[model samples]
Target chain A: MNLTIREALLAFRRAPLLSALSVTTIAFSLFVVGLFGLVAVNLQDALRGVAERVEIVAYLLPGTPIEPITLATKDIEAFPEVQSATYVSEDSALARARAELVEFRDVLQELERNPLPASIEVKLRPRFRDADHVNDVAERLRGFGFVDDVRFGRDWVEKLDRLRQVAAAVGLVVGAAFAVVAIIIIGTTIRMAVLQRSREIAIMRLVGATNGFIRRPFLLQGAIKGMLGGLVAIGLSYGAYTLINRWLIQASFFSNEQAVAIVGFGTLIGLFGSAASVGRHLRRV
Target chain B: MIKFTNVFKAFPKGGLALKDVSFHIAKGEFVFLTGHSGAGKSTVLKLVYADEPVTSGEVRVSGFNAADLRPRDVPMLRRRLGIVFQDFRLLEDRTAEENVAFALEVTGARRSSIAARVMRVLTQVGLAAKAQAYPRELSGGEQQRVAIARALVNEPSVLLADEPTGNLDERATRGVFQLLRDINASGTAVVMATHDLDLVRQAPYRVIELQEGALVYDSAVDESRDQAATP
Candidate 1:
């Protein structure tokens, strides 16, 4: 082992209580952020599920020729934003109404003549499922000669868009606030660790140890503490997620990428926090 | 070798800690820096070690000038000089041997050679048998010896002791004083700062006295003057 690494590990053994305190402080701070991350991930998942129902339905004119309707379906399908387009004839629409509308099945069955209009249902790609894209696709559908009307629940789509915007803004602001808080807390904790060993630092300097040499062990120690804290936080987050899933509601845990990101965030904070603290101390002394 | 030429040091707030004080120590010479508390004894040592900046004038230690020494060059300058304080200054957690080895380790000495070098210094300090004892487990004299061993492990040319026996009992103080004399006998220059008049009188080494931050007497010059006036 390298001397820096040996010294860093020796510090943990020398002051086990302080080391444990630092790790716990980091872990709890990260746990809060992890909890918020879980909420954001789940919220995004739910929003995506809701957005999948967004569709543009175009009612066809009575007696419209089927040939142009088929051609129109192909044109709608070719639209960049359109994921798929399905045509339902008037007779089939009536049959679907009877099958789906339980209370209206009798009324749909008793129809003397087919009153239901044929329609083309347009489903947009995932990225294009927002209000603007849906409205654009609907306007294009209305341009068809046989399209009598285009309906895609404009108010509902706009509301969903608004909700999405608010969620993103809140997530950004709150997540940043949480991150800053975590950084400050972790920095203070690391500062305390530095202060506790100030005597050792003074001794090292007296013995002709360069500033760089003295700082290396501290940086390594901080990074290790942060990594351990991050792992513990993830474990805590998982436990929370499991409890929520078991008792509160159906919820999902972080994906592998997300979990790794949380840990990397901790490591970076540890590195920077130690750097700032040690840098300040060295300058002062 | 160390030299101070008309050095002036001011306190951070105000007032001079050293006023126009100057002296020189040749290789392998033993000197006593005697003054009451606050008489700039520690200030002079700090200036020599580059622990404090000289307000004005020159302080050259082992060929490094303190007037414009860069921060990075401080460690290099100190590497050639060993410093011990009144408070032993040993890490409480480390054993006597480990404490001495720490000095060598910090200078990036060879890993294979650290153990032997540490033991040699410990034995020289007459604490080889207690190498595994922690500071708390040892007497004041033994702890100070450990500190001396740590200082000597690097084989510095000049050893600076600032009240090295201030916290020791009479017997321990005498013991540590003898060890310093032995170290000096072996060709290492020793500049010991103390107000222990008895210790200063016990040796025939040159004595430099400071009064209120100003050099009052240097025996090397004043004593020669006394002989010339013998008539």
Candidate 2:
């Protein structure tokens, strides 16, 4: 609608090879970054999902009464972080163990008495399912007289934290590299466009056109290329992610029906945002 | 409307392109600048448009001092003065109509206005039928005409043509000179630099000739014919 828009459209239409090549460069660069982004997001989601499936077991004191433990279990369930908690009495635990060990039932009968401790099995809300939050809650529960021991998986928690730190560091390095490459690609393309249009630019200047008017078409060209490239990258990244996800599901490696919830929106938004950012950077000069 | 007062332009190798050159052209005057090769014919035009600064002395055009003109104001000076080159200098990629419209387009003319003005100028140059043709598709004369049309698109008060017909034949040259005369008659000051002595002697305009960067001849019916005796 605007004059600049007309000029930009003319520039884009005039140079097909240049426009295509520029857009393709942007697409390929962003595709690499987007692909990595999808992997990082899905990995974090998968790990978080696995952590939520683990349950917490709080052992009761040897002299604790079943009624008090049941009351404590109900109170724990009322807490916002606790998903559900069930009281397991000693007699019920011994009976369940004997039924499961039919061969071991004779071995268990050979023992002097049924030997199993009463415990409360607890599940936490998804938000509180991380190892750090679960451990914090477990420590708080241990202060209760009914809770003789509180266990969730301390070693596993520490290991996952270390791995997450490493992954984050790697992501930072890779993201920085991608950003530098994107800038170089955009700068070079713009420089080439400037050189190719130097004569036209000289003539425009001679004809009393301002620098702003002369530079507008090039800026528009850069923006158009960036947007087209971003769209391409998004499409390719999502298509590949879908195929890989389907293959994983068929192989039974992952059971969740929706493995990549954020992939679609995040990838699309990120692609568009980065493309716009590059456009702005190119225009500033 | 141009004034040159003792203007001295020097090249890097101490070559004096114009030595103590001084002249003035009033509104609607047609003038010719003739000289041998490297006699500083184009250099004078360059000075008028502020393309090159005077080494010394004063040069003024359209109320702006060439020496005091800023870089940003150079384009404004150029817009008021049309320049026609020997090579036509048309954008080889654009059509004749587009080339003519380009001058108006750069001055932020509306698309409708540009179209109208370009059509008018192309018709004036007798190239209305060839408006869609590329520079490569036109004859040498037509291309030069297109350049002339571009120069006149802004309706410049002062049109400076440096060998506008250098590549054309005698008939094309006469046609181009006739067009210049028509434009000059219509209140546009025309200054043409050419080496064609016969065209100068035959066409009959105020002639200023330079021999080695010095004005050697000035002949006009209104003038005293005093400088013609000096050289």
- Find the candidate with the highest DockQ and give its number: 1
Q: Considering only N, C-alpha and C atoms within 3 Å, which residue pairs clash in candidate 1?
A: none
Q: What is the Cα-based lDDT of residue A201 in candidate 2?
A: 69
For all the models shown, what interface RMSD does each have? 0.5, 1.5
lDDT of each: 0.94, 0.78
Candidate RMSDs in Å, in order, are 1.6, 6.0
Query: Which residue ranges in model 2 land beyond 4 Å of their true spot?
Result: A53-57, A62-138, A246-285, B4-23, B33-59, B65-75, B195-231
Q: Candidate 1 residues B1-231, lDDT tens each?
A: 799999999999999999999888999999999999999999999999999899998999988989779999998888899899999999999999999999998899999999999999999999999999999999999999999999999999999999999999999999999999999999999999999999999999999999999999999889999999999
**Residue runs of model 1 more than 4 Å from their true location after superposition:** B227-231
Write model 2 residue lDDT over A62-97, tens digit each, in one string. Answer: 878767777788888987889999888888888888
lDDT by residue (A1-285, candidate 1, tens digit) is 399999999999999999999999999999999999999999999999999999999999999989999999999999999999999999889888888899987887788999889999999999999989998889888899889999988999999899899999999999999999999999999999999999999999999999999999999999999999999999999999999999998998999999999998998899889999999999889
Q: What does DockQ give for each predicted structure?
A: 0.87, 0.50
TM-score of chain B of each: 0.98, 0.95
